[model samples]
Target: DTSRPTDLQRLIDGIIDDLIALEAPISGFFEDVDQLKRLRHSEANDYYQQVYGLEQRRQAYLSRLRTQFVTRLGIRTEQLMRENEQRRESIRRTTYGRVEDCIQWVRSRLEKLSAMEFVEDLEQLEGMFEEHKVDNHEIQDFRQNVDESIARQ
Candidate 1:
């Protein structure tokens, strides 16, 4: 008995929520329209004007929503790219950096390096490159340099 009849109940919660979220006016659709409808049909121009106003407001809100969405998407894409670059650097430090240091040490003492150790180091470095999907001009040049060093020895 406490509940109002369905016909008397308010059903504009969705519109109210949007108005609150977007800080937009109702565009005189609810409170003013009923009074407008009560007027004679001779004033049909008033009804059309109100409808047009509402349409304009809706379109403006849609434009704002789309702009905000695109801006957020762009920010997220840039963030993801930065995260990927960071991970690549971390991998390089752990994999390529360590291997490069070992290779450099071996090169510095090539005269004392055992043939087996040199071959093992070369293979390990190559494996590290392949495993990490490294593909760049610098890395390619380094690989070529390693091959040439081994050939010369």
Candidate 2:
């Protein structure tokens, strides 16, 4: 079997992928003291420092990522705001049209009613006192009391 040179790129890719995918108690593998402790042996102390530097780079990348996320969010919010304004105007037009239609229907129906018929319909209100359980005699007494009080004033 032929021996191949060490795949440094593959090792770096695997490490970066692991750092990105880390979660929970294993989060920030490069920053974790316990994980870095393994690389801090007398022979590899310099390597540990390099790993610490990589962690700082990851933090810088995270800052840039947040900026990009905010920019995209602002653009989407502006687009949605414009869309909502258009929708509001459309709803206002629809509501006005519906109100006008209702008014026309009511006017047409009222025009069909004769004055005598309308008067008869209004005269039915005379019975509402009993329907509402209100005594007409008590109302007359109250009205007389109010008239006397107003005269005194």
lDDT of 1 by residue, 2-27 (tens): 44434222322244235435422343
lDDT of 2 by residue, 1-153 (tens): 132223533443355345444322222442354344434434243543455466446544533433454343332345435634654564465446545654565565456433323235554766553533444443343343344334322
Q: Report residue 122 deviation for candidate 1 (angstroms).
A: 99
- Each candidate structure's TM-score, on Cα atoms with residue i matched to residue i, is 0.24, 0.27
Residue 31 lDDT (model 1): 30
lDDT of each: 0.46, 0.43
Candidate 2, lDDT over the whole model = 0.43
Model 1 sits at a Cα RMSD from the real structure of 28.4
Best of the candidates, TM-score: 2
